[model samples]
Target: MNLCELLQATDGVLLQGDARVSVQGLCYDSRAVTPGSLFVCLPGLHTDGHHYAAQAVAAGAVGLVCERPILGLPAELPVVQVTHSRRALAQLAIRLYDAPARRMTMIGITGTKGKTTTAHLIASVLRAAGHKVGVIGTNGVCWPGYRQPLDHTTPESSDLQRLLRQMADAGCDACVMEVSSLGLKMDRVTGILYDIGVFTNLSPDHIGPGEHASFAEYRAWKSVLFRRCRVGIVNADDPQTEAILTQHTCRVVTYGIDHPADWRADADLTLLRQSDFLGVQFTVTGPDGQARSYRLPMPGRFSVYNALATLAAAQVLDLSVAAAQTGLQKAAVEGRVEPVPLQAPFTVVLDYAHNEAAAENLLTSLRAYHPNQLWVVFGCGGGRSRVRRFGMGEACARLADFCIVTEDNSRGEPLPQILADIRTGMQRGNPRTPFVEIPDRRQALYYALDHAGPGDIVAVIGKGHETTLQRGNETLPFCERDILQKYMKARSS
Candidate 1:
């Protein structure tokens, strides 16, 4: 494509360049620069890209995309300036890759919790409707025969474009992606325009120096999805919903269970359980003549919200009510309320509930099933908020019959110290019922399941679909499902 054409697609102003300048490739890192390559300068948490402009220039970068003012300039090197470097990179990558998002329907789901679940549900929803769908999120990107575990919620600009291009090549009709706050803030999703954007819910999370600076900043970054999409589908019951939606330029659609929302649910929100499985069942109705009954394998009232948001989002894409209904009913999300069959005695589930709110919610839902004894196996991540330990521990004590505390991604932090923090909260919530600290997660799960009676429920929390456990400089192989199934299979043998 011509240099002028590229700038037009990127919403970038060419400070100086010939329209006929041939483009070979695009890159952000200075090291990736070569002759005919355009280097995009993005400001990072640790360093400024403007500082590296000289290096990129020296590496034979013919063109540059930047938000910063050029310091020392050569007359021949062409530059394009934009309001934001990340957004510009996304747009440029999209144009360079031939606008793949426009050729395919795209769906984005954002929230503090339920993002992975919502994305999974939407992908299944689309596939059930006879569409070839691709999904990118917690379980990595998945298609029919090809599956690759993605390292980021949203990948780098070039990588994202490549994935979209591949999906387009593979004849996929739709793509569903999890839109993390980090992704939005960093402009990881710059180029693709979404057909529909779904907001599951929001809370105070991912807030720190390297992440969002404050709750207000987190909300602002999340708002970018609505601003960029054609339709903004949101949870009406969320306190942050109105504020998030009010600033969006796109058409708005809402779903909820708390109030009589546009897409509303029935009065009964029940958590149902059999010997080996537990889930939430509810009926939904909407002003747009929408009605369906769904029994999600996932638990908690949040599951209800996740489903409704998905349905409303499907509705925005002009899908039939029946198709959306079927999509959600058969939707399967890995790690979020993931099931593990145990014939030995009790029901066991593996979930990535690593936060206070999610832990409380999951435990509360399990409690509703009336298990003879609810056994929670949980732990905290290292280098995070130590305050969360108390909250998560207390939540399990209040809801679970007992808990087996263990390690979750303990990198450079002592497991004993982390266990001590959790014990502070557990002991404070209820000093009764046995609680043990077994630093190793696999062993802790064993202790819980081995002690469980026929009617007991064992929930292994944290490290859901993740295959590798981050332990200091080493990455340990850890698959919760594999560990759990092996143990259950041994008893059978």
Candidate 2:
């Protein structure tokens, strides 16, 4: 592509050099620049990409897209100036990647929770219906034979476009991605129009410094997806549903258990707790008014909502109800109320509930199982709002039969201080609730498993599906599933 051709995709003014300079690639990181690459200077929270313009140039960046004037650059090098480099990068990437999202059905799922599980469910449904599907979200990007980890739920626009192009070239019929609030706010999904947009549920989250200024802003960003998609599938049961749908440009389809909607699960929901499975069985009535019984191998009413959303999307796509049943029945999401196979009398589940709303929802759902004892081992991440530590502590204290507080990616903060804040919340929630502090997460998991009684439901929350543990600027390999399997095997032996 020529420099002038790429500039046509962006609202950028060419400031220097030949418009016909050949462009082979695009980059944002100065360290990753290569020969004939166009480097985009993005303004960030921690540092400015403009400062590294010289570095990118030295690293073989042939042309530049920047928000401000960069001094001391080659007089002949191609330069384009844009008002917003992030948005410009998104537009340029879409053009360079051939607008791959337009070639296939695109599904974007957004919410405070359930985005990952819902995305996987929708992908499974698409596959069962004989459509090749690709999924991108918390679990990373994956298709039939490809998988890769991502640093963010919704990747940067450039990386996202490249991945979409790969999926399109690989013959995928549809793509389902988790459109995060930050992703929308940061213009990560800027140029892609979705075929279906889903809102699972919303709550107060991702609000603090370097994030949304308030809960209202966070909700508003989530609402942005509906405006960019052709159809909106939303959770009608949530009180914030109306607010989220405000200013939405798409046709609306709703799903809920307590409310009348296009898709709904009856009140006679069944909670399953077999020896090898823990899930919910419910009957859903679609827009056609045909009721079908479906069993999801995941627990809670929230899981039912996820299924409803998937079914609603399936209905819109004209997929068979049989496909919805088969796909949902076999779908399993890692770290989402995932049950570990154990020979012991007790059961252990893993989840990625790091904040107040998520923890409360998961724990409360488990409480409905009527376990002899509900044991929760969880902790808050470092450098986040102390309110989360307090909230998680309070929720666990009130809901769980026992609480085992532990470390969760302490990052650069001291473990003791984080634990202390949790203790404060625990005390506030229920001063009489008994609890123990285990600073090491590994030991914490060991303790929870070692002491669990028969018929007890032990939940290990936070850091679900994550492979590393961050502590004081160092990230160490850590897999909870491996730890649990090793311990259970040794104990059985």
Candidate 3:
């Protein structure tokens, strides 16, 4: 692509140099710059990208996409100035990747909870329907033969665009992704128009410094997806459904268990079974006035909502009801309410319920199983809100019979201090709840597992599906399930 054409594509003002230079590639990171690459200078929280413009130039960048003009760059070096470099980068990436998102059926799932699970469900259904599918979420990005981890729920725009292009080239007929509020707020998904957008549910989450300014901001950002998609699928049971639907320009579809919606599951048709492990059987009525029964291996009220939204998405995508049922039955997301097998009579489950709301939901749902004792083990990450730590502690203390406070990614924070904060919340919530402090996560797991009596359900929360544990600056290899499996094998021996 010519520099002049790329500049025109972004509507950027060419402040310096020749526009005739042919650009071979685009990169935002200076370290990744190659010959003939156009470097996009993005403004970040920790550091401004403009400082590295000269370095990018030195690394053989022929052109620059920046917010401000560079002073020391070669006079002949092409410099295109834009108002917002991040937005421009997203725009440029779409074009650079030949607008791959438009080539496939793009399905985006967004909300405070169940986004990842909903995405996986949708992908599974699409695959079952004979469509090659690609997925991008917190768990990571996956295609036919490629799987890679992501640092965020949504990758930066350039990377996201490249991945979408890869999926398209790999012959994927559909792509499902978890769209984060931060991704929308940051304009990472600015140019791509989704074929279908689904909202699982929302709550007050990710609110604090460096995340969302307030709940209003978070909700608004989450609602941005509806405006950019052809069809909007939402959970009608949520109280804020109307608020989320306000000013939405897309075609609307709703799904829920407790409320009237375009798609819904009647309470009489819903059944939850928990003889040993939990499972849910429900019949969902789609927009076409047809009921499709689904049996999910996982059990919970939220699981039903996830299934409902996925069914709605499948219907919107014009997939058959049988496909939705088969997909729901086969779909399983790792570390999401996943049960870890043990030879003991007591059952143990692992989940990514790191927040107060998620912890409450998981533990409460488990309580319905009538376990002899409901045990919860969880820890808050370091450098996050102490309020979150306290809230999680209070939730576990109030919901579980035994609460085990342990370390979870205490990056650069003292483990003892984080545990102390949790204890404070526990004391305030229910001083009578037995609290055990274990700084070592592996040791905490041993304690939780060793103490479980007959018919006990031990819930291990946080760090679900993640393979590494971050402590200080180190990301040590640690898969909670793998560690537990090894322990169970040794215990059985």
Off by over 4 Å in 3: 268-277
Per-candidate RMSD, Å: 3.1, 0.9, 1.6
- For candidate 3, which ten residues in a row score worst on lDDT? 268-277
Model 1: per-residue lDDT, tens digit, 196-278?
89988888777776887789999989988998898888888889998787679888888887775788887688777776667
Q: Which ten residues in a row have the lowest lDDT in candidate 1?
A: 11-20
lDDT for each candidate structure: 0.82, 0.92, 0.87
Candidate 2 lDDT tens digits, 413-483: 99899999999989888888888888989999989889998888999999888889998899999999899
User: Which of 1 and 2 is the better model by TM-score?
Assistant: 2
Q: Candidate 3 local accuracy as lDDT?
A: 0.87
Instruction: State how far residue 421 of model 1 sits from its true place (Å).
Output: 3.1
What is the per-residue lDDT of model 3 for residues 1-493, given as tens digits with 9 covering 90 to 100?
8878776667699898888998888898899999989999988877888999999999999999888877888888888999999999998888777889988999998988888888998898898899999999999999889999999899999899999999999999889999999999998899989999999888888898889999898999998899999999999899877778778999998889788899898775343544345668877787778776788877777888888888888888889878988898888888888888667788888889888888888888888778899998889999998989988999999999998888899999998899988988898888899878888899999998789998888899999889999998899999998898899789889
Q: C-alpha displacement of 41 in model 1, angstroms?
A: 3.4
Q: Clashes in model 1: which pairs?
A: none
- In terms of TM-score, how similar is model 2 to the real structure? 0.99
Q: What is the TM-score of each candidate against the true structure?
A: 0.89, 0.99, 0.97
Off by more than 4 A, model 2: none
